[model samples]
Target: MCIVYAIDSDWGWYYFGCSTCNKKVFKVGTNVRTLNGQEITSHIWWCEVCKENVSFVSPRFKLHLVVKDDTGEARLMLLDMVASGLISESATELLNGSFDELEDPDELPEAITQIFGKTFTF
Candidate 1:
C-alpha cells in the first residue's frame, strides 16, 4: 500500500481533450465571425488523431502524485479514468466548479486534496 501525501501541482492537473474522441486537443487560435451582424469569438482546437478541428472539448484529469510506501517515496501519474474513479468526480465536473481560464490549474480542489493522507493499494 502507498500513502498519498502530496500532489505534484507544478505541472497542473488536467488537459483539454476532444469530446468525441477523448484525445488531446491543441488550441489553434480564435475564430471570429459575424452572427446576425453581432461579433462572436470562439476558441478553436485541433485534434491530431481526429484529423479535424473540434469546437467543443472536455477537460480530463492528468494528475501527478507524490506517494510514499514502506520502501520509500515516488512520483506517480494517473490519467483520466483512474483519477476520476479515485476522486469520484470527472475532470469536467471539477473544472466546472471553478473558472478554468482564470483559476490556477495547480491549485487543486477539496475533492482532490481529500485524497491526501489516505492509503491505497495500487
Candidate 2:
C-alpha cells in the first residue's frame, strides 16, 4: 500500500505521477472514521513505489481493497476498523438497483460481517 502524509492543510491532497510508470496520479484525503464513530483522518495514496493504493491513517485501523467488477465500476473500496465493533471480512450488498440511482452506505447482504464492510464504518 502507498503510505503518504498530508503535505498541506489547504489541500489535504497531493497530485503526482504514480510510481508505477510516472503516470499522472494523485493521493486524496479520505476522512475515515473508526468503528466507534471517531474521525480517523487518512489518505489513500497511489503508491509511487509499489504502484498500489495504500492507507495513511492509524495503523490500528483495518482497511482492505474493495473491488467492484459490476457495470459502472469505480475504484471503490471497503474501509473499516480492524477489530472493535464489527466482524471483519464482509461485502457490501446492493440495497436496491436495476432501476434507481444507488446511494452510498448501502445495506449488507446475507451473513453480514462488519459495519465498515458496508461503507458505514465511520
Candidate 3:
C-alpha cells in the first residue's frame, strides 16, 4: 500500500509504443516514391529497434511519483497498469485527453491532479 503525495509531470508521463514489439516508437513522416515517378509523404509510427513501420500503436505510461508514509519519502517509477490504476484512468485516456497539456507539473490534468493525496494498495 502507498499514498501518493505528488505526480511529477515535469517529463512526459506517457508514450506511444509499437504494438508488435512493445517498444517505444516515434511518430514520423517519410517520403515514398511511387512506380510512376510520383513522390508521396506518409506519416507512421516508427520503431527504431524494430526498424519498420507499424500500423498499431499502444499507449504506455512512465510516471514519476512522490509517495510517503510514516517511514519517509521515496520516489517511484510507475509504469503502464500500475500507473493507470493510480489515476483510475487508462493510459489511452491519458494520451487522448490532456497529455499534450503536460508542459509543466502545474499544467497536469485534473485526472492526474486528483490522484494527489490518494492511497492505494500496490
Candidate 4:
C-alpha cells in the first residue's frame, strides 16, 4: 500500500476513448466536405486499430501520479475505471465541454488534485 503524495498533472490526466471499443480515439486530420457548393471542414475521431470512424467517444482518465510508502516513491499510471473511481466523476463530465477547450493538458481539475495524500491498496 502507498499514499498518493502528489499528482503529475504536468503530463495530463485523461483521454477521449472510443465508446464502442473503449480504445483511445485520435483526430488525424480535417475532413472537408461540400454542401450546396460550399466547403466545410471538421475534425473527427478515428481508431486506427479499429479501422473505423467513431461518432461517439467519451473522456477517460489517464493519469500519472506520484505515490510513496515509508520506503520510497514511485510513479503510477492510472487508466479508465480506476481513475474514474478516484474522482467520483466520469472523465467526460470532468471535461465539461469539447476537448479542444483544454489549452493545456497539465491544467487539470480540482478533483484530480484532491486525490493527493490519499492511500490506495495498489
Candidate 5:
C-alpha cells in the first residue's frame, strides 16, 4: 500500500499531486521530448489552494515526477521525472492509490475506504 495523497479539482475531475505539493493537472499530453532528454509531454493542473502544478496522465497511471530544488522549477522537473525513477516512494504510492479510484469512476468515498481498508467515520 504505497500512497501519499490526492488532489481534486473544480471541473468535477481530479488528478494525482506531488507528495510535497498537492497539485492536480487537468490537461495531459505525451510523446514529446524535454530539454532533459525526457521524451514525454506532461499535462499540468495548478492548485489554487496549495498553489502548485501536478502532472498526471490518467487516473490509474502517473508518469514519474521530477521534483525541483525550488517551487518555480516544478514545470521542468515534472517532465524529467516522468518515465524515470526520480520521484520519492511516498509520492508514488500516494499518486497510485488516488489514480486507482479515479479509474473506477464508480466508487465514491467508499472506494477510498475499500482500497485502504480503513474506515473514515464521517
Candidate 6:
C-alpha cells in the first residue's frame, strides 16, 4: 500500500478529449464562419485517432500523484475511470467552466486534495 502525499498539479488535472472517441485532442486553430450574416469564431480541436476536427470535447481526469511507502516514494498517474471512482466527481463536473476561468490552473480541487494522507493499494 502507498499513502498519497501530494498531487503534481503543475500540468493541471485534466485534458480535453474528443467526446466520441475519448482521445486526446489538440487545439489546431480557430474556425471563422458566417452564420445569419454574423461572423463567429470557434476553437477547433484535432483528435489524432479520429483524424478530424472535433467540435465537441470533454474534460477527462489525468491526475498525477506522489505516493510513498516503506521503500520510497513514487509518482502515479490515474486516468479518467480510476480517478472518477476515487473522487466522486467527474472532471467535467469539477471544471465547471473553460480552463481559462480557473483562478490558478495548477491548483488542485478540494475533492482531489482530499486524497492526501490516504493509503491505497496500487
> Better model by TM-score, 4 or 5?
4
Model 6: ten consecutive residues of lowest lDDT? 97-106
Please report the TM-score between candidate 5 and the true structure.
0.27
Give lDDT tens digits, candidate 3, residues 10-107: 66677777888878888775556576787755447789889998757777887888889888888888877677766767778766743233445456
Clashing pairs in 1: none
Question: Model 6 over residues 17-51: C-alpha lDDT tens digits?
Answer: 89899989998887799999999878889999989
lDDT string for model 4 (20-52, tens) is: 889999976667899999997666789976898
Runs of candidate 4 with Cα error greater than 4 angstroms are: 29-43
Comparing 3 with 4 on TM-score, the higher-scoring candidate is 4
Query: Given candidate 6, what's the lDDT at residue 50?
Result: 86
| Residue range 1-122, candidate 2, lDDT tens digits | 22211111222111233334434334555557686867665556565566677553121112233323323323322223322233433222222212122232232232232232343322
Candidate 3 residue 30 Cα shift, in angstroms, is 6.6
Worst 10 residues of 5 by lDDT: 113-122
**Model 6 misplaced stretches (Cα beyond 4 Å):** 30-42, 99-103
* Candidate 3, position 76, lDDT: 89
lDDT of 1: 0.85
Residue 117 lDDT in model 3? 87
Assess the local accuracy of residue 109 in candidate 5 as a C-alpha lDDT between 0 and 100: 38
Ranking by lDDT: 6, 1, 4, 3, 5, 2
Worst window of 10 by summed lDDT in candidate 3 = 97-106
What is the TM-score of each predicted model, taking all chains together? 0.83, 0.22, 0.72, 0.82, 0.27, 0.83
> What is the total number of backbone clashes in candidate 6?
0
lDDT of every predicted structure (CA atoms)? 0.85, 0.33, 0.73, 0.81, 0.35, 0.85
